[model samples]
Target: MTGNLHAGALLLAAAPIGRPEDASPRLREALSAAPVVAAEDTRRLRRLAGDLGVAVTGRIVSYYDQNEASRATELLAELLAGRDVLVITDAGMPGVSDPGYRLVREAVAHDVRVTVLPGPSAVTTALVVSGLPTDRFCFEGFPPRKAGERSRRFAALADEPRTMVFFEAPHRLAATLEALAEAFGADRPAAVCRELTKTYEEIRRAPLGALAEWAADGVRGEITLVVGGAPEPAGLSDPADLAAAVADRVAAGTPRKEAITAVAKENGVPKRVVYDAVVAAK
Candidate 1:
């Protein structure tokens, strides 16, 4: 059924990544007022509510990855019934590498109003605190677990020009860092932020190789990784070098015109210069 004027909205709440006090006032109000609270971890939600000195007055249900699909259907029904269903994850915003996506999508499909209670996020927290270029960046979530998949994924991103953020478990941090070092480069600048916004929080900024070595000694707490983007290739002034660069891209199946444009941009030269070089070589 389509939503009516009295239909309830779906609230996607952001939980504090570490400190309970980071919880927003709107979140506290929603916790106490929502007709149904879908939590990634009910136990952890209870603890957070208690720590916030706010008792949740709604029915609490588990809504983690295992039952996300089925639970989304149920929650959508609740919204359709004029009951606000608040979705919260263990930490950070719901549906961010988390379980709220299905419910949000369902609610939208059913014309149920959906909104967000934005607050703390590990992605931005790490990126801002990493001292890296924040003008342009991307969140990669987590790397693939299998060695082959992870290697291929990193290889694909090796030429990415924007700062990158990632979430990773403490247990796999060492191996992941090593793999990133191998794929990106040993000297790539990176930061490993652990237990952010909590006691004993640590931000270790170093080259990928050194961070890999440090993590091998064993680290703890939640982890967020920030890595610098690939450095711009040195500007090519030599016509031979510029022509060769375009030729290499053309050989790799890139269109000649597109290759010339890319080579011009990469080497801080003009398109005319690269075009002339390509023509001169031909």
Candidate 2:
């Protein structure tokens, strides 16, 4: 019953993450009324429509990573024709590490009206349940498959102060945990949310090292990892403070030159500043 249907618009619909009962009435209406429904999986779309007992009168087309570009153009044309097109994914909202982004981007470029029928999102769901700080967080979809690439990915985020969310395959969860522990430090707190909103749901909250060890036994089902952000670096209010830190490292057997460099890097200040402080202390 949305006026945009006849006026031509792009509707991004959110599908239920697990249970069909969670589907909203607006989703049912959108599925039944849109001129065309672009789905990540056509079969899943049909199945979801069936579950909702809503007949999809419009055409259903697959819109996945492989065919997104070509299909997005096609959908944009439909939008230009003044026909509302609804975009949906297998689960959760479209465009969240899903195939709807290209279509949405094209729609915006073409001056097509874009709207969302928001519903379930695995990202927020896992974040709230993660027991980590949620005031600030970032989603790092999926890490690289290669060991070296994954290590680099974690290394880049090692100093990030926002909570981090990630999706990982069951088989690789343990290895990914190990890599995270190594990059972020073993005692960094994190949580593993498995099969969210589904039967056999499990949430394991602990330090990265403990989770790594637990996952070594192998894990199954969908996985969402939430890692606590890096603790804030101590403030260096005074040059004397910098000198004291460098001196501590030096007393721990690090050479004066190396300690100054390390302290400068850690404090994100200039080595010259730290060296000046060290000299002033002497």
Candidate 3:
């Protein structure tokens, strides 16, 4: 049975990624108060509601990739009719590499109010604990499963400066990590966060090569990989060359110390490298 549509509002709530205790109060209220709830997996939704001690008072319907397009039309009509509909995924925010994008798009086209109750997200959770630079980062939902395609994808981002995050199935983790190491370099730092927020939650930080070796034995859980960005451009191998580059900065009245730091940062090298260059130039 449909509950109150609340002026045809569409609420996008994030379900707990793992631990149900992480579920926010707003999520509980939304689950119990919404007139209609569209879930990527209705069974999982029921389980989550149970864990949160929330009895979903609203009508729950299956909404997933396979049926998202058709479901959007039906859900949109309900929203337009002033029925409050809540859209949630199996985990994390809907429309983020998950279902709910279609409904949100339809809701906007029909001038329906759309809102979000942000909560647990594997992407952000993995990033923060990834030990990788969070200031500049990008999320690449899931890598292409095919070997050649996956290699090409990693090759395309070979020179990416921003830290990168990607989701991968457990069974393919080892092979994917090896490809990443090959394309991004073996020594590139990275983190493998698995089953985040779950009882067996594991976070392993190491060079891509090491991670590849570790996962070779096989893993079992949701996986998120955060890889450090590519190093600075090539051809500045000579310390003398780096020193010379900093010389120009120093000439511009940017103190030697500042010049060295700036040059190293711009070239994505260790500050010590630039500092040693300045010292060696003297």
Clash number for each model: 0, 0, 3
Which residue pairs does candidate 2 place in steric collision? none
Output the TM-score of candidate 3.
Answer: 0.81
* Worst lDDT 10-window in candidate 1: 1-10
User: 104-137 in candidate 2: lDDT tens per residue?
Assistant: 7877766678899999999999999989999999
TM of each candidate vs. truth: 0.86, 0.90, 0.81
Off by over 4 Å in 3: 1-7, 234-282
Which number leads on lDDT?
1
**Model 1 alpha-carbon drift over 4 Å, by segment:** 1-3, 235-240, 243-282
Candidate of highest TM-score? 2
RMSD of each: 5.4, 3.2, 8.5
lDDT of each: 0.93, 0.91, 0.90
Candidate 3 residue 12 Cα shift, in angstroms, is 0.6
Candidate 1: C-alpha lDDT: 0.93
- 150-207, model 1: which lDDT tens digit per residue? 9999999988999999999899999999999999999999999999999999999999
Model 1 clash pairs are: none
lDDT per residue (tens digit) for residues 14-71 in model 3: 9889889999989999999999999999999999998889999888899999999999
